[model samples]
Structures are given as structure tokens and as C-alpha cells.
Target: MMDIVKNKTETSNSVWHVEHATLAEWQAVMAWAKDEGWDMGLGDANAFFEVDDQGFFIGYLGKEPVAAMSIVNYSSSFSFLGHYLVSPTYRGQGYGLKLCQSAFAHGGDRCMGLDGMPAQVDNYAKWGFAGGRNNLRMVGQVQQDYHCPDYIELVQAADIDDIVAYDKSCTGIDRSALLKHWFIGETRYGFICRTGQEVTGIVGVRQSQDGYRVGPLFANTPDLVEPLFVAALSAVPQGRQVTLDVPEKADPTLIKLAEKHGFESIFHTLRMYRGEPPKEQEHKVWCIASLELG
Candidate 1:
């Protein structure tokens, strides 16, 4: 059983000790997340924070994990900061401030991208993060006749290199390593769009509480997104719901596509950054892999 709380005699300021998360802590963290309605996928959390990472911290009040966060290093391109969470019981007790400061210290001088929740924008802005693009969480019931283009196919291990290469150039942040772990290690479906022998687009679909979700959906053009969406949705179990996140500035066609397919916006967020935001186009992002990792 996980320890629910711990108090130390060394500090009077309620100093929360933050450490790396263990595989077994999934139960404790996830239970708290479910209780808070996060729709998290704890099963995938292990692989998501693989051994190769430079930062993944869990805050403890005594012996209990009360807050957690990770900073993924990306060299000069920019590091991504995410997985920041404070347990419900310990929130508003200065634990979140410690967690955020620790996360920034871990990230160092690199720029960070985070989809700040609506309520937390002002709080994050106080930390030097400026609002960037909108990250909309959209959902819809699967349409029975959703037709996939013939060229898309199931991805193999060998295709990872190609996917990484495409992802590196398509997005400002180099997330090649995370892509490998997310696509292969998490047991999610990897669908690739091809034009002749050339790989043109890629998408990943994973299971969540609401049903299947398509995330990190990357393609060269807005036109390619329709086909990619079809391929991603095709992998979902019949009768289950399908959801996709959309970047606010994406092609107007995408909104029509979502509506035509019966999808609706569930919530939206501002992708904020401290210092300068990256130069890549948020308009092309069709899905956010997760709030924790994005």
C-alpha cells in the first residue's frame, strides 16, 4: 500500500520533498487524478517517463507523494515542462509554488511550452509564461462511415526513424525520443500516411476513459489532416467515442471537418510559455498527446 501522508520534524514551513516517480506510485497518483476528473491514463505513465529522461520529480509531504512534474530537455530548440500536479489535499499550501520552481530549475534556461489550464493562466503568467495559442480539447461520437484513405497503414518499428525525422522538422521542439516511447513503448497504434514510397503524415491513437483519443497528429498540410483523422479514428473500437485536440489557428477546414464528423469542443486552453515562444506554427497541431506531456 502507498503511504497517504508523511510529516517530517526537520522543517516548519511545510517543505515538500520532491523526488522522481516510481512505477508503483501509479496507483496513488492515478487514484488522486481520477478523483479530480483528469481522465488520465496511468498505464501509460510509466513508459511516458522512461529511464532516459533528465527530469521527473515527485513532491512528498513527509513520505507521501503530493505533487509531481517533469522537464524534458531539448537542447537549444527548447525544453518542454509538464506532468505538474499537486494532490487535492495539499493544494494551496505553497506546494504548487515549490513544484513549479523546481520544474523551472530543472528546465534551466531553455524555453518551455505548456498548455496552461484556463484557471491557471494568470498564475502561470506570474511565473513569466505568456499566452500563445489555444489548445482545444474536442470530442465526438465516431461516425460509422468514416472513410480512411487507402495509403495509410500500420506503422512498424523500422518506421520510427522516419516518423522522428518528420516530427523533428515539423515541430519546433525535437521530441524524437519521446515519440519513440509514446508510439512504441505505450502500445498505441501508429498510423502513417504515405505518398508513394514517401511518408507524408503520422498519427497516434491511445485509449483513455472517454474512449480512444488521437493525439500528436502530425501531417504536412491541412488537406492531409482529414485522411489522417480518418485513419486514427478507424482504429477505435466500434460504438466508442473518439476525441481529437485542435490548435486554435488550424485551417478553417478542420473545424468544418470536426463538425461534419460530429465532434465538438469540450474545452480550450492557452499554450503559454515563459520568455519567448517557439517559432513553429501551432496552426498545424491537430492533437495534444496529453496535458501531462504536452
Candidate 2:
């Protein structure tokens, strides 16, 4: 669906090699992602590699990079597939399938999840992905007049451990590495709502190629969602484009809240699983991290 062969001119004959990409070589895939309108975060290259260094795979036609895919094994029971792409020069030659199989083989028998474009849903089904749910990418410059609750505070260094633990409790997946990358100064910002030392909720927003993206919005109770969301959006300058990837199965109130704040559905990705899906606390999550990494 990304039009892999959109403007390419390539020789008909070719051979491809698939292998893990080092942190430096991974930058090439990021470049291609930018070319394809992925809108990934600036520090994603380093942060994603930390999840599983050997998880990022690249397929090369001789010495030139042609395709890339990432299957990050966050835990032995869970792996997430993302960044699937093929160069414009190499479509119609089965190279994408080759790269996909290579990435999938790395997951072995673990449940693999991915958020894919609608055009590829059937192909993914044939490859064993099913149970698709739409994850809407909501965009808007939300305006909030309410003052931040005293319980809500900017994420501090000391809050990292609790935030990581809280995320695991809510999502049933340990993505501490990616969460850690959220407070890396300028690129990302985070806020946590606490009640007498108890973490009530947390949200993170990061700069992206397209706009500021708010994700992984989790709460202990539904009451905590709005404050955390308001706090995160407050970090972005007024009128800047902001995005939130909200799963179709999230709490109904969260959907209404997003809609009430002037946010509109720009597009959506289909969240599918290749095996047993994660048993996350859906009601507590307002948005997921980017589809490419979630």
C-alpha cells in the first residue's frame, strides 16, 4: 500500500539477503520510513534497537538496502512487528515476503502483533494475522482551559521505575526501554497523575515528523484519563498538529472525550495478531505508542 514500486527503475534479475541491522545501519531504514510518511519519532532508531538489538532486520539486494522489518521481542511471550517496508526499486519480485518471513521466523512461536494499513489486511490474514481492530489516528490542536490537577506532575527521573511498572500492569507487556526513551528531554515529554504516592495515570507525548503524538495513555481509573491527556497536550504549543492512536476497543468514554476535544479521525490502522493476543487492560489505555512499535 505504500507503493513500493511507485517511482523505481530496477533490473529484473536480483538476489536478496536478509540480516539483523546494527544501530547505525538501522538509520537507513528510518530514512526510508521518513520517505514513506511513517512519522516515527526522532530517537526511535536508538530506542527501538534497545528492545532487541537483533530484532531489526533488513533485506539487501547485493549491497543496497531494499527492505526492512522489525519484530521486537519485548518478552518471550510477546513480540511486536513493525516498520515493514520495501524499496520502490524492488516491488513485484517477492522481496517483501522474503523480508517478512525472515522477521517472522525470528519471533518463533510467540504472539506477534502489528498495526497495518487497510490495504494489506487480507494479505496479512493469509500470512496468519487475524482479529483486526481499528486503531484510529486522531488529530487536532486540542484546547483545554482547565488548570492541571495538583496530582498531575511532569514525569521526573525518580518516577521512571514506577511508570515502567505501571505500564506493564496496564498493558501486560514490558516495554520499559521504549518508555524510558520518552523522557529524553526535547524529543518527548511525559506527565504522571499520582494520589498520595500512588501512580494514578501516565501519558507521554513525543515529537514526530508529522506532529506531536500522545500515546500509551494509561490510568488506574477512568477518572484519571482526562487529566493526564490534558497535561500531555498542554506541553505542545497551542494550534500545533497533535496525534493520538486510539484503539477501537478502548473505553467508550475515552472515545467521546477525544471527540469532544475537537479531535477528528484522520486515518486508522488495523491492529492484528498473528497468534494469541495480549491480555492488556484495554479500558485503562487511552492510546497506544505508535503503531510501528506497539
Candidate 3:
């Protein structure tokens, strides 16, 4: 639990104090995301905290929490801003901007990126985030009857090194800590595609607030993606909906795979960056890890 200690910089006239969130406070932030209709993975907070404990932030009006945001520094050259929210009661008081500023200060000199809600794109633009690709969130029921490819196999602890390497190649970000927690958990399932001893693709599905979510789906080519996708959905319980976010400019066949599996576009966010976007292998990324973490 977080101790509610007053900072030395706090002044009597200040309406709110911004500080890094403790583990318990981070859980509160994830709960807020769920309440806002965001389908978050059950173990996201734990994995996220391990990535960068100082990344999460919360604002408080004395003892009451009012705002939250995250600025995860992937490396000296890159960072991602996300989990931004301001309590309804505190709107128009500049609390969100204060929190945003804190994040910016914490990520000095690094290129920052965010998945901004469509309605807030203009507001983010004012803060230097230039719009890039659109990320579409698609949802659909798992097709239990689909045949699983014989080449696809369940991920094991031994496969961690290869998986991490493949992920780094796809995203251009080192997230080994996050992947460790995300891949080895009771509520999650991970699958890999191989061409005889070499990993060619990988995907993971985890229990979410509403159902299941498949993400970080990466493959060397479109042909290797479908099998991994089908294998992931097959691990989920029958009749449960599975959601995934895909970059709009991804290979057209990737979208067709979603449609073939009965998925529909439910919502979207603008992928914006404050500096040069990371030189990622976008064509290999069939699905993103999560909007909150990215």
C-alpha cells in the first residue's frame, strides 16, 4: 500500500500533489481503466510495475486520488506515454496537464509515443504528439472448431530466450521483464510457430476484464500468423470473446484473418509520437501488446 506522505514541494495553496504510484495505487489505476470500459489483462499491473516502478504516477488532492498516467522508458532513446486519466470531478482544473508534464520531465530527451483516444488526438497534438497510424481494436467470439496447425506448439520456459529475441526484433524495444511475467502465468496461454528449431512467430492470450485478449502477435510473414492466431483463440473457453488491436496499415491479409474469425472493429485509437517513431518491423506485428503499456 502507498503511504500518503506530503512532499516537501507541496504548498498550502496547491490543489493537488503529483507523485509516483505504489503497487497498490497502480492497482487502483487499473481498476479505473476497467471502469472506463477498457479491457485490460488481469495481471497487467504486476508486469507493468516490474518494467519500470517509477513509470506510474497518480495525483492526489490531499488524501483523495484524482489523476493518473504512465511514462514507461523503454530505453534512453525511446519511451511510451499511456494510462492517462483525470477524474471527472477534477476536470478543467489542469490536473491532467500537471500529470502529463511530470511524465515529460521523467522522460527527458526520449522520443515518446502514445495511443490516444480519437476524441483527444487534437489535445495530444498540442503537447507535440504528431498523429501516425490508427490502431483498431477488434472483438469476436473464439472459433473453437478451427483446426490448430500441427507445427504450432505451446510455449515453455525454455523458449523464453528465443521469444524475447523475436519480440525485440518486432518492436525494437527490450521488454524482457514484462514478457517474463506475461508469458508465465496460470491465467495466460502462449504459443509459438517454428520452422524446425527456429522460432518464426509467437502469440499470447490472457484472461481480460470481459473475456480474453490476444496480443504481441508477431510473425515473420502473414502465412505464419493465422496458425498462431487460431492456436491462441483455441486456448480460450468456448463462446468467450477475444479482442486484439492491429495497426491499420498492417498487411491486408491480417485484417482478413480477423474477419474470417468473426471479429468486428469495435473502437480505435490514434498512434501518435512526439519524435521519430521507433524503427519497428510493423509488418511482422499482427497485434499490439496493449494500448496502456505501449
- Clashes by residue pair, model 1: 6-62, 19-58
What is the TM-score of candidate 2?
0.89
For each candidate, the alpha-carbon lDDT, in order, equals 0.70, 0.80, 0.83
Q: Write the per-residue lDDT of candidate 1 for residues 36-142, one digit (tens) a residue.
A: 65666424566555523546667776677788766766666477666667887778877777766655676777787787678878888888888667877778887
Top candidate when judged by lDDT against the true structure? 3
What is the C-alpha local distance difference test score of candidate 1?
0.70
For candidate 3, write residues 118-228 as lDDT tens digits.
988888889989966888899999756655678898888998888988898888888787898676687887898988887899999999999998988999988888888
Which lDDT value does model 3 have at 144? 69
Let me know the TM-score candidate 1 reaches against the reference structure: 0.86
Ranking by lDDT: 3, 2, 1
Ranking by TM-score: 3, 2, 1
State TM-scores per candidate: 0.86, 0.89, 0.92
Candidate 2 backbone overlaps, count: 1
